[model samples]
Target: MKMVDTMCNMHLHNYKDILEIRRNTSDFMWCSRELNLTKSYRQYHDLTDPYKFQYDVFRSTDIQRLIEEVSKCNNCSNEEVSKHVVEILKEIGHTRQMAVFRCFGLCFIKVLKEVISCVFVNEAQILKLKSEMGGNPVIFVPSHRSYADFLLMSYITFHYNIEIPCIAAGMDFQSMRVIGKILRDCSAFFMRRSFVDDQLYRSVFKKYVQHLVTYGDAPIEFFIEGTRSRSAKALVPKFGLLNMLVEPFFNGDVPDIYFVPVSFSYECVLEESLFAYEMLGIPKPKESTSGLIKALKIMDEKYGNVHATFSEPISFRKYLTQTLSATLDFTKRDSVEESGHCFHLAYQIVDCQQKNMVLNTFNILAMVLTNHLMVNSLEPLLIDHVSKDVVWLSAVLKTQGAVVQPISHGTAVSVLMESIKVHQSLIRVSASGTISLVKLNNDKCKTLDPQTLRGHKLSTDMMNLAVPMLTLQLYVNPCLHFLINSAIITVIMQQVGANSHINKNSLFMKFVFVRELFAHEFVFYRPVETQEFEDALTKLELLSIIESEPLRLGNHQKLQALFCNLLYPFFSGYLSVCRFLLTADNLEWEERQFLKSAQERIEEELISGWLLQPYCLSLDMISSCIAALTSMIVLSKIRRGSQVHYKVDKDRLIPVISHLESLFYLPQKYQTRDQDSLEDTESIQVISSSEPLQRLVSKL
Candidate 1:
């Protein structure tokens, strides 16, 4: 990728830098004084005031009227309603004291600096957004990737002189004792994970959020995804909080709300281990103050650099005006209709978040390195291959409209080396100077079935590799979404061959099909416009990756190989799941049970060296693939006694599996046709069929 000049020079700050900056700047006292001087602020200056205000809003005459109207059928009393209001407030409210906010902000900056090297990218966009903030309530919707995400947004705004936002935080942190209280004081409002059945809490929380947007001067911040993404890519958005935040704009309480989508890319995530466990179907540990303290013990380790890119602000008023051409009259709508409208708006916001995500050097490097590792080709040609792939990826990202760091051919190795050092524990260099992943030596690996240990007889070595590869997959995950369309087209071209009459509609259908198949493996936002496939094909032709006239194609054998390599894991995992479903005696199985069995089966495949696609070991992706299959009618779902069970349809199942299996075979020029047999092939095979698959078997 050609490096372009960024608005601000990248700022790299060490842990001690925070202390030095704190000592040099005495603005804390001034900030505290400013906090004390304002009357409205004073009224809510105590740590408990915001919570009380939320209760007041809930108990307001309007809310009481609505509650009475909604609950009259049940003969609920005013006292009972009042009691419910208190419970709702306790669950959803938070207090913000300027003094406490300032203190925590300082400490947060210090702790963040100590733990990770933070880099703020696209500052020019942030400056522009900041200048445009005053007329409307600004909402900062950053992609959530790790626990550190909570602090990064606040730190960036404070560093740039913007007011710290009133953040919406999950109730998971509410139990963190002193930390929880401090977070509340620092402008974080705790929210229940789900309020589906709690109408009272939902109503109260909605009003509280609306109050903030209408009155609060500071910007409002919350993750569009709702929670930290376990897979490290943007999750399908949870619309509840987003709907609540945007309601004020539609209600005409606020003239407009500007949403700033921020994307955070990490060289190494603080919650990598936890996320890995969660992906393996292991339940995450509950959040607690003691756990937080224990986690702090490992703060001294290096976490490399974190890049936060702020995309251009999106106006909610303008968006709604465009989406809903008619004047909106929220007053005329029922609760259900209003919710449906809000969900539609939430989807638009999610799209903005997805587009705003910038792929940086760290993630790109991880992807390139991980692909090489998966193929066992990193040893002899590690530096050379990584360098070439990085350059290729840079150009590809640039073409895809991502803001990649300027990487010269000379510096690519150094950049990758830095990444290796940052994730040193997961990757290692042997005495022979060959690179390999650290093997799992834990009790967890020991208990795994021997059939799952493919190449290694011992469980420890198997796990060491499996665990690190899974973590590496997290870093690689985000990049896949960007490359999916191109990958689909490239793979199809290789299958259909050059000089063949390729039907555009058929190709588009195939693109959609492959995209859906890997939906769980990669989280991608489906574009509203149908032109994405056409656009990708057009670009590929322009780049000579494919030819339009006579439908000839370029020799993208190397490129096609890389794309196949990236997809191998998902295909293998899906194959394993399908195989398991085929053999299992139970025609119908609960979702959780099926997922557990699929994971165990994949692990066994990995251990027995039967599955060469390391990335396929993820239980999250397996579960998602199963859901996708059900949607495709390859699997039928039956709800029995409150539990959903799935039964595979043999007819639908065969075609879908065949299509996925075909993706593993590259064009002939890209492989050796004489490869011993299908059994000897590692991850993918060379297609030798006479149909479309045989078209490209000839030498380049």
Candidate 2:
């Protein structure tokens, strides 16, 4: 395997490169019973007393002052407000006990070994980060991909003798009966999904977070993405918790606050099936102890390796002085804080997270298969073609600075076969030696109720095809960040004519428009657009895919097709919204009603052969399109009581739709077939691989 740069901190480069020196263990050893069971008891443990911590946070001057201030504002007695604050603290606080921590560590290890082959972490970098943990508070902002993410970090810290961070968890887990109390004992603090209207709760939560930051004994951990990304893409960072985190540094409570962006990449997530169903308009099952027991059946299966990378630690103090140039005035007590500064800093952490993401073989292989299925839907992919395309795509991603795992020399097919074996629940190879996606059981959702769906209800026919296809696309979504910019250029040039010349100015204009159009769908560091654009051009030039001087096209036809086809579904999904808006020029619909209308309209288009991509059946993308349109002012939003309604401004929408339509065109071969293929969902089923490497399936 080829090694990539694992360290992101410049100062840490002076240390000996340990990541390069450490040899990767075999998959068998990664899942070994002894490895998972072993523990180092002699390590220093600086665990905080949860009871004292809570009392400290409650009695802190910040919380007391805020409580008094809120009581005065509400014209209430201080005692009443104090009682309310105490109740709020109990709801949100964590209770960390060393006994529970050690006991849970063992249980988590057993659970983890059952499902995952390995958890690959850079020890040297983690030790370096641990050394820098003193004198100020630290925040570990890891990307959220799975429920397992919450457990992994705490386990790692315990193994490495570092203090376990007090994690911010959603209230969904807080109601999971005994499991909730256990998690709290393991240092997981619960917070509501949204407390925007509850001033007392919001103030208490902020003060609780600020107290955690100010104490400087234990690290505070939270998902900068705020929630698990169903699509597995880096979400636009949430500002509520982030604003609270940095407030201390702005007010001189801490000299510096360190923000570490940790990226977790899974070969396959435990929630793959659930996320797939949820994306196809089915509501996610609520978190509960009963549900937890039901999910234990998945422990019999094997999810491949996971890579957790700790990127460079960002100092708020340094960033304020260097990046923002003291744009935030700390002296002005009455000055309002602009969200733009927070946004810049948040995106910076997200960018680091993306950069440090470790792409497994399955990620690249899935993308190759998705690209193939776009052109030849009925055909199975040959092993040779799969191997070649995997190599080609891996090279493409590496050139763009993506951290793709290297294909072993001359063993690409075997490596890919192993990946397919690990993810056999998702894809399969036949006795004929050709690979295809495994069809989701059509009868699985027969008992599903329509009214319970979180989004528009779809027919069983759509669900059969949409579920597995979207699941396949979920693996492909992580690679989108590396491909989106260049792919946009490819589509633009394809519109102008593949071999035609276009000025840089004209290409950039189209690029900016499309970027803004999908702003809600993907993460784009808005402050650095010019630099991102220039970097995309440079990457394309380095790959010999395009020319820089006067902006001419290159001869890399296969690479161009890869880019074009990879992003085609997204454009198709977004275009459907534009076409829908064109028809409903003056019509107004409530926000939920608008989304349902758009989804139903798109389904009709897909079935009637007007739209081709089945992957475009994403409710997330449909909602993201509406959000983008509203932000762009192509659709005007108005409030009526508790409901929000949208009206399309045809004048502004026409040009936008025209531009979208200009960039989008589907060839006949790539389009969907007639409605006859939709008669029975069973016809979509394909045979599983011969013998299917079931050795890994039944027993690791």
Model 2 Cα lDDT, one tens digit per residue, 1-700: 0112233642212223222221343333322323221111111333256666677778888788987898899999999998988888999998876667666666666677677776778667778777666767878889999988878888677656667778999999999999999899877898999999998799889888887777646677899998899988888889889999888877787778888888888898889888888877788888999999998998899998887888767877677556655465665534435435577778888888888788878999888777656553445567876786677678778777788887853889899999999889878888887887776557756787767765677777667767777888889999988889988887787677646789999999999999999898999866678777888888877765677666876655456556777877888889888888788744687887776777888777766656655677788888788889999998888999999998888889889888988998562122222212211111122222122212111111
Steric overlap count per candidate: 12, 0
Candidate RMSDs in Å, in order, are 7.3, 8.3
- Candidate number with greatest lDDT: 2
Candidate 1, position 668, lDDT: 25
TM-score of each: 0.84, 0.88
- Judge candidate 2 at residue 615 and give its lDDT: 73
Worst 10 residues of 2 by lDDT: 675-684
TM-score of 1: 0.84
List per-prediction Cα lDDT, in the order shown: 0.65, 0.75
Name the regions of candidate 1 deviating beyond 4 angstroms: 1-48, 323-348, 429-433, 445-461, 498-501, 520-529, 608-610, 636-644, 666-700
Local accuracy of candidate 1 as per-residue lDDT tens digits, 393-504 = 6776667655566676778767777767887777665555455556555677456554442222333444455566778788777776566677778877767865575777
